[model samples]
Target: MTDEKNSLYGGSQSSDAKSIDIYDENLHLAEKQKKIFLAICGVFISELNGKEFDVYMNTKTYTNVPKNANNIKEFGQINFESKDDFSARLFDRLQKTTHPHQFARISSMLKKMCSKMTSYSMTNSPTKLFYELSLEQRAAAVAKWSTSQKASIRQFYRTISYVARTAFWLNPYGIYPAIGYPGPDPEKNGPRFKGRTFPEYEFIKITEDTNDLEFDVVIIGSGAGGSVAAARNSVLVIEKGHHYHQSQLTLREKDGYEKLYELGGGMLSEDSSMTVLAGSNFGGGTTVSWSTSVEPSHFVREEWANDYGLIHFMDDDFVDSIKNIKNRLGVSSSNVIHNENNKILIEGCKKLGAPVATVSQNSASKLHECGWCGFGCRYGEKQGAAMTYLKDAKDYDVKFIQDCFVKRVIIENNKAVGVEATINNGDKKFKVNAKKVIVACGALHSPALLLRSGLKDKNIGKNLYTNPMAAVYGIFPNKEVKAYSGTIQSAVCDAKENVDGEYHGVKIVVGSCHPAMMSTSFPWKSPLQHKQFMLQYNHIVPLLIIARDRDPGQIKIDSKGLPKLDYKLSPHDAESVIAGILTSLKILVAAGATKIGTCQTEVEEFEIVGENSLNDPKFLQYLEKVKKVGVSNGQACLGSIYQMGTCRMGSDKAKSVVNPFGETWDVKNLYVADSSVFPTSAGASPMITTMSIGFYVANCILSEKEFVKKRQSAMLGTPNSTFTDNTNADKRSSRRRSLLSSFGSKRFSMSN
Candidate 1:
């Protein structure tokens, strides 16, 4: 073995010798061995036919044998001669047993024994018999042990074949075993409430008799930015979508997509080259995101400051703003536990001498690692906008109106006064009057709203950025790695820095293996071939490559005033993606993966097998083929979660939509507070950076004495002319007369 392999396996010979002695001294191995022996005996008993055997099997004791399989006495009266006869029957029945779950359990136990023996051999040099064998080979050798060992190792081969058959029978689509998140439970957990503590409106009946509502400040979109801004000020938040409490979320992919995601989870770019995943619910992306809380990179900050003229990004106050947001969200690595999926990436990166780091998350406690943030954390442990800032805003008596879609900002003389909106998609229009209006509707919709509102800024919808991502899968034979069992995206490999070149900033992170997601991403050749891959689902490891592209895209409004993304992958960025895939493949090989596959469409089920494939010349040839076919044809299944820069922030009004403080350059009292104002791609996950920008904008608004003074003055009726109802009184003359009478009565009562 090479020195590197030795280090990876454990340590040098002399060091291993000492380690072996210590391990032997602490041997609880005998107990484990006894348990395995009993488990085998239990399996034999399960095949026996007798009243006693039936009674014992019905007790469900055999199910626990994988932990502690019992001796013959535990099964009751059966002699040695009978045992030998039963063993013969078991050998015969093993060939015909239709119980796939039972056979799977037996196979798993035998594999564990093999792994234990391999570890023992690796530590104790004198017993290095199976130390170099692959996991599959080791498992095969386990079956050759003596009959006295209690396990029927010979039947294991049949069980393996049965698993393949059963896998096909179970999944027709060749999907991974479906693991579901906890669904909404109204009886047990009550409503989601999200962050709202104050009263909220979901159904509003605005008739002619009803007067227009007035507020000191009106905020559109109840996402991360809107919620934070609302907390410090008494604002009325108008959300186009409805709120779903913890109990309201169905936790199924189809339901979540339809209810919580943008465009029913099928939002694509104008060219159909990328699928954009953005939230359109109460708390927006925070409610559905993976909870990765990466701070803004220094390179990105410096670039924005020096190149884009957003100098405030480098200020100490801005740094403090980021720190405050981190503290509020409890962003830290302390609660993160690297599961098998993440551990594989860490180990592989270490073996290949690549930079790796633990990802900080917004988990409230270590005990709250449920691996279901994509479906909304059931435990409310994720400190998203709904749980933190929006909750705080509710305490300040901030009102909220759900399902109230704002059509346009009510701009009078180039200044935002309020907004005009429809309630519950109804025809009855309502006008909300306020001193200022803030748009926090995310990157895609923010610019579209500006365009629909008749803003003439040339840069309103330009400079869109997306962190394009692709995933690679590694299958390790005979290893059961349940990738869906722990926290999603717990670690990252910094392959961008390791590669020698500029514009190659790629972050390779662990990806989710949820059944629906995996089925779509894993490349398929035919139904049978796909089923074969799904059978190895438990052994699959996925690595997601997020490439930071320098080239920018644009977001334009369609004829219906909806956002349309126009992005074409640049050659340099495409090459960077391919580079990331190669590095990911090398890491997988190093980590003992037996086969590798890419999500690229034109790759045509190409796979690299064998431990030595990393050193094989064909490996390079395969990668070259991937670069030619996948990158050139844009065949890689690409998606983006980190969307930004549509309404970019800068110092120049002619070049950008929003200023460094998040206020629009073209419209007064109208500010933006989302990823829309990001000047460029934040070379990392943009959650914390986006939240930090929100805090900075909120602070700027709070410090604006003139705006605050105007808001106070408007509330006290100093700007009576600003509150325009614009309702057609002729259609409802009687209702209008009644409203006028009420207004006259109110004026008389006030004068008295």
Candidate 2:
């Protein structure tokens, strides 16, 4: 065994200069910080004694591990390998995504955890540190903290649990083989058919001291919006993340997050209310999003026009932009294959006579049944913006700089000039002068960037909205239902949506979670209890109830000048979320699930004995129990993959950060063409809406008589092709209006 002090588990630096120089060059955390991080996570890993291990192994008749090991120490919890320690993986993630300002907050949290250990007297040793606690003491503390009523106590448990479980499930060296999860093997996991083979894109990689960059238009993101806006000639796209073609895509959770996500994935909100997942890599959310491509609902568009005074939302040009984006991306419901989860949703909805709709995906050429959509697509079937829009931009000679972070938009007298950025984490810095500047860094970072650039407005980072989702897992013991495979998301149950007729409520959708996501989200009670739940992994199907929050949260810049969410679930939305959960439970009952569980810690699962219906006395009592507890922050895990409305677009200059034309009110020729500019909650996936806004913003630039150069004029589309809207939804039969008489909108107000 290697000495602990000299080990690569983020120990003290060795005296040798070559090894220290090489690894130290990339190291972001101090040796003490790294040690503290590892100690905090190590305590939560739940080291089991011999008897405890036996109890956990015998908890369930089923086992997710194909070759379930009996040894407790070999699981990597009790004893860690030097090279594959949690600190190495954790710091690697930090160096890639998290900024120093955020790290301070994290470090503070770690110190708090240590203080908690000392206060609880868990560490009987003289050191009185969390790392010095006995294995038995640490395990007992985790049990108490996981279900604690206090938010601060729960925060310690959740944050450590997220990192610890990720270290096991996401890493190849941790527990992949033990859990039967095969890491990224192209030959084994990729689709059978060889998908599209893209040409070698000449992305200018910044390796050395390169300077003096210039362009006609400089877009500061590579997401659903920015990729579409890159249609003009002489466009230079600066993406904070690097690109990966189909072959280079790593389907592994750990590698995918390090490469593609904002703040290294499983990102929680400021108050730890919801897990906010935002993409940051080459194609942004398009590269990492579940392939469901939904447009802003009709009611939302009307709301933007009527309430927000953004009448252009319903204009012909706006409608035309949506239509054009759909055509370009080939979004359709034709020949779609529903996975096990979607199939269960459809079957259950039919039994209850609920309205279900087929969702369109960007992949229309062939079946994109490859289940790893949350990670980048190795199959190249899903038509992400990188595949379609950015490829088109490249064909039109639009140059792109990969792995570049824009410091701020260079404004001269409040007029857009260009951008200043650092490539590959401050290795090289340069300024790109441009005629137009587009801020499309998504809902989270776009506002943060504006705040950092000395832009002041009450509405800069306000009006933030998310489609917060809660999960109800139904395990079918009779047959195999691998929820992680096949088409990720393809169907929806809108029986609960628009219950108010003003389009405010919830929608039921299916999600595809790999092992890492599943572990972090799967509700934990005790070590043995969680193991029992996970043993049913292949049989469990999740129905995600997404509440379209009415009361919006605001994004505030923290002391580090970074974006932080200052939002909580409002009473109105809490009712909606709880109502959706109750409805989902009924659907699962109708689907004839053997056992049903929720993300909430207090709610007990209702396992069927012989046969049970929604109206059965036992199930009814369980439903009552769920409603009694309701939804609250820190009680359960709530997650949101969708974020919007931060740098909002509206007609009123006083109310919105950007105007209806997508230009910022304070700055001329500077635009925001992303989900950040959504006037309100889109109430659906914002991919198509975001892309259409980008398309519209690009046209706005082209229409400008002063900025439109001769070279940009050649980008005029020659394809006058008009396609039929075969992807028509929302035309449901009137009989579907019957939304389960037992649980209606009136019952949602559980004030009694």
Candidate 3:
């Protein structure tokens, strides 16, 4: 071994991991490039030795913030776990967690990224290895990349930063202890939900020796869509993810990503301009999301009917569908207790005279003040798909098999007969023979599934819209505790939601944040500064600037047949995001924030000098800096919380993958019943919209008690139902019976 003083890399291997060597793994990258990549990782996350200890987070060489302004304090008292072999821990997890090919691609990119970073850094020659430079010099190098004149350089920085920071804050092993973050809180001692447990569902695990099964219908997902569509008996819902019950609902940040989210909660667009978060568990997003139950805005409905030919979206049936689902889920804002974050948002919006409204939750109107909603609701109060639709279907003996990945739909002579799938990551090959098939996979995966099934419709993966969001955080030091433990979005602003007159604008709301989530999404200024912000996690509150994106992205499959999102922030959408950021800053200042931070990586945080209004000259200048920096390609941190619009439902076959009834245009008897069927972006939380569409499409399949009958019955009541409710059970059962009997007798077919 080389002498300790002459070590080439800054640190030793991470943790106790022992396995494949990066160089031995036949990667297509050069040896020097691989070393360069490892060095860069060392620069971002390390143990902070004698020369590296920084208390005040002096980053002024790159950012314009005042030196030693003393807004944030040093955290020397606490014993941080990251101080002991953090670099080693991070690399150990990276090697074990990331796929080999993906790692190779990242290493190759890192070499190029470092060269450009140094050139832009205005430091020493690019010949020096990035890690060999002083700590500040290295951070300054990376900081310049965000403000680089070249878009490519900016994108490179964004990609690298995302990979590095997410690796650290998403908690490989040491992060929770290092940052002092608590894991899932499903305890009896809590004030809200007390010692409640979910009733068990009969979930079968698919095995290598499992036999073929037959059902009346086979649904290829278990989210809000598939759960509702499983209204018929003899139905089989195949889920790619396993069932995460109450005991494991809200896992720790890292565990949650591995167990509940798609792509380990790090899926990104092709350009890395947006981070896409989608659930992969049995209940899907409804299980893990913030449960913001909202009906479609009226303007969005008008667009679907007038522009996209989705007339039903504007009809009374749609309204009834939303009402029926909302009633069943008990979605209401009555019992919401806004956290300090939410309270400040409302106060600031009100002070600015911006229109604001309370956002509803599907927590059964129970007092559920959980900031960890994104990890999956620990409390049983969240009426997710599993608790509502799936629970209802369970009584009818609708079967379910978890850990099943449906490979493709089985098409025989232009009809979907069933589906072929591999369970437990190809441990078992099986086929489910069914009379009808419903592909209820969310937007990101539905298109890939269709394409894999050999459907040639051009719109299968097109027209995708994610209500992309950017966040701005404010520091409220006066709060006794760090401020993020209650409800996640109890309020939203309509001040700029319809700025484009077409409702193609933005919505402002408070985001649910915990330490791991807070730190990862917080752009890294320097190691010390980033850690300092993590120390201030409790005092920080982030506001989401969500946009009703007019521009669209598409989902495409890679050589491995996995979904690859292709999206870039179009100029118009970028403008809307910039406006939202400025508006968010204005609100923060008005709300009496001592310090406000923007997500743009190269920008300086605004520190309150004195008492000031929104129009204060210094604050106005900061706003201008924000606007000028804008949503530069990959420079600003943006996220897609509700991905939608792929495989959209419409009348024109050339423009849409599915028909008005949600049946695919290319094949009969196969339908899509997820957010993918939205005529455009739902322009609101998509849980209600996806569930309503699922309910509507399921009715279409059973040839429901005519539209008029549903309208009349719905008009007479509030449409609520419990798992044991039999009010509409007979009607639903009769429709399914008639449809099944027709199929059994060979007297009816979906193609008819």
Model 1 alpha-carbon miss at residue 441, Å: 0.5
Per-residue lDDT of model 1, residues 372-426, tens digit only: 5676665577788888888888878888876566778989987888888765334
> TM-scores for all candidates?
0.68, 0.85, 0.84
Encode model 3's per-residue lDDT on 1-752: one tens digit a residue.
11111001101111233433532353344556655555555555544444445533442221222222232222322222334554454454454334344455566566564574544343354557664666557666666766677766666666666667666666544334333345455452474445675757887755666788788899988898999888543589988876767765444666666567776666667766777888887888898888799988877875675455555665566777888898999999899888888889889988888878899999887777877777777667789988888888888789888767788999998899999987544547899998889999999889999999999988889989998888999877665333446787899986777656777889899876765457656677666667667655666778898889898989988664667888888888888888888888888888888889988876877788776566678888888888898875677788888999999886566688886678887687899999998878766789998898888888878873364245334333332232213664555445434433433443223443
Off by over 4 Å in 3: 1-31, 47-104, 110-127, 131-137, 150-152, 172-183, 186-194, 481-483, 704-752
* By lDDT: ranked, best first: 3, 2, 1
Clashing pairs in 1: 38-69, 39-69, 192-245, 192-246
Q: Candidate 3: minimum summed lDDT over ten consecutive residues — where?
A: 2-11
The count of residue-pair clashes in candidate 1 stands at 4
lDDT per residue (tens digit) for residues 187-209 in model 2: 43434536447545778856566
lDDT of 1 at 609: 60
Checking candidate 3 for backbone clashes, the offending pairs are: 14-88, 14-89, 482-538
Span of 10 residues, lowest total lDDT, candidate 1: 2-11
In model 2, the runs with Cα more than 4 Å from the true position are 1-40, 61-87, 90-106, 109-118, 121-132, 172-174, 177-180, 185-195, 205-209, 499-501, 705-752
All models: lDDT? 0.61, 0.70, 0.71
